[model samples]
Target chain A: MWRGFSMRVVSAFLIGLLFGLGLVVSQMINPAKVIGFLDIAGDWDPTLLVVMAAALATTFLGYRLVLKRGKPVLDASFRLPTNTVIDRPLLIGAGLFGVGWAMAGLCPGPAISAAAVGGPAPWIFVAAMACGMQGQRLIRP
Target chain B: MVEFTPLSGAVGGFVIGLAAVLFMAVNGRVAGISGILAGVLTPVRGDWAWRAAFMAGLFAAPLAFWLATSEKPQVVFDHPLWLVALGGVLVGFGARLGGGCTSGHGVCGMARLSRRSIAATATFMATAMISVFVLHHLAGF
Candidate 1:
């Protein structure tokens, strides 16, 4: 059990490392770049669209091929999202998230990754985000 | 377009896809940034360990990169402090209520052909574009 737990932790770290590196290499961590992608009426950047397409294409093939196997390599079963219905909360919540992302040009992943290399600004954003999350638990719970 | 890097974007995206695949294969987990961050904050038994490790690796990767290459991600904040904080709050709340964000719905979930993820991805992306339009084109914000 201990061995399995350690393996999971180590692999998780490596995977996270790879992800962060991808964000940096792709320059997704740059707010100017992301916002530029959003600035459609202005000088819009299509680079992000290509990045998303490349990721989607690769993962589309990857998931289909991998799921054909009996089960995931490490776990007993594949853990996948089962929710299918589009509801109000999903819509409203997504709208809010989109607006927020546009305002700051940092999603959760980029925020954390940015904080690793930055000053107090990212931390403040993260702290505010935490409070918002905690507020959700309180208000909705 | 202000600036573009097609090759690096595609290559980085490919790396991200591979990391997501490895994460799902070995850990049987979705590499959703919001979900993982929320999980760490909520802390259900036996679940927080991997989240913690993954987050640690997020920071560690940039640190390692800086050590090796003397470079880090470049981020700028043009918004007011209040707006930035509010943006963070909305992102946190919205991601929690919406169920996932770019990594989950946009990349991993859409790739899997999950209907709900497809819907969520569309909704969030649309809103993101709209928000950008309103902020930049309409209001010059």
Candidate 2:
């Protein structure tokens, strides 16, 4: 059991490392680049669009191939999202997230990755994000 | 003007997707950064090791690159500290309430052809674009 658990942990680490490297290589770590992509009325950068398309195509095919197996290598079953409700919270929350994203051009993934190499801004953003997350839990939980 | 980098974007995006596929195959979990970070914050017994390890890997990516190539990833923060903090808060609370962020909903969930994810992605994308337009064009930020 310990061996299996360790293997899962190692795999997760490597996967995260790869994802971070991808973010760096794709220049997603740059807030200006992300904002440039979002800026349709100005000097827009379509690089993010290409990145999204590539990621989507790969994931679309990759998930199908992976899920065809009976179960995961380290787990008994695939732990996928079960929720399908398109409700108010999802819409409102996502909209709020969008506003925040445009304001700073940093989402959760990039923010975390950027904190490693960026200045105090990323750290401050991360700390505030934690507070927000905890606040939500307190309010809802 | 923002530089176009379709080649690196596609390459990096494919790598990101590959990491996500590997993670799902072995760990049977979604590679959602916000959800993963939240789990680390309020860790439960027997479930925190992998999450911590994944985050450690993310942090290590920059260090590894710096050691190997002696090059740090570019990160720009044009917004003030207050806006950054506020954006972080909204993102954290919003992601939790909405149930997922870009990686979970935009990449993985959409790849699996989930309707809820699709709606959330569309909604966030639209709002983000609108917000950018308002901020950059209308408000002249």
Candidate 3:
């Protein structure tokens, strides 16, 4: 039991490390780079497009191979998202996220990763994000 | 205009995908940053441990890179503190309500060819582009 728990924790840490490294290396942690990509009406940067395409392609092939296994190594079943309905919450929420993303040029992954830099902005953003999340729970729950 | 770095982008993206695949293989979990983070905020029994470990790793990546390379990753925020805070709130709330963010919906869910993810991605991407246009061009911010 201990072995299984440790394995999951270690694997998760390593994977998160790799993901954060990718964000840093790709310059996705830079708000300027993200804004440059989103500002198509201005001096648009196509780098993010390449990044997205490459990520999608790699994940496309990688997930296919991974899912072929009957079960994960440490877990009994894949905990994949099962909700299929493209409902109101999905659209509204995505829309809100998009606007916020453009306003700040940061997403969840990069935002959290950026916290390592130890600045007021990232921390403030993260703290506000936490509050917003908690607020949502308060409202919904 | 932002400097284009296709090679680094692709490499980083591939690494990100690999991490996602590895996470799924070991823990059978999607590497969704928002969901993982939300789980951390609201701890559940027998969970949250791996999530905390993963977040810790994410927080460590930039420090690790800086230690190894003596260079901190660039992070710039053009928006004001209030705007950034508002954006953070929106991102946090929207990601939860939407059930995923860029990493979950854009990367993992799209890779799996999920229709809901596709729609969510489309909505977010389009709105983000529009928001950028408005902010950078129309509003001249």
Candidate 3 per-residue lDDT over residues A1-141, each given as its tens digit: 989999898989989999999888888888888999998878778878888888889888988999999999999899988889999989998999898888888889989888889488988889988887888788776
- The parts of candidate 2 lying over 4 Å away from their true place are none
Clashing pairs in 2: none
Model 1 steric clash pairs: none
Candidate 2 structure quality by residue, lDDT tens digits, B15-133 = 88888888888898888888999999999999999999988888777777778889888889877889889989998998888888888888898999999889988988888899989
The lDDT, on a scale of 0 to 1, for candidate 3 is 0.88
Better candidate number, 1 or 2, judged by lDDT: 2
Query: In terms of docking quality, how is candidate 3 classified?
Result: high
DockQ of each: 0.73, 0.82, 0.82
Q: Please give the lDDT score at residue B124 for candidate 1.
A: 75
**Each prediction's whole-model lDDT (CA):** 0.82, 0.88, 0.88
Comparing 1 and 3 by DockQ, which wins?
3
Candidate 3: residue pairs that collide: none
After the best TM-score superposition of candidate 3, give how far the Cα of residue B13 lies from its true spot, in angstroms: 0.7
Query: How far is B140's C-alpha from truth in model 2 (Å)?
Result: 2.8
Please give the TM-score that candidate 1 achieves against the real structure.
Answer: 0.95
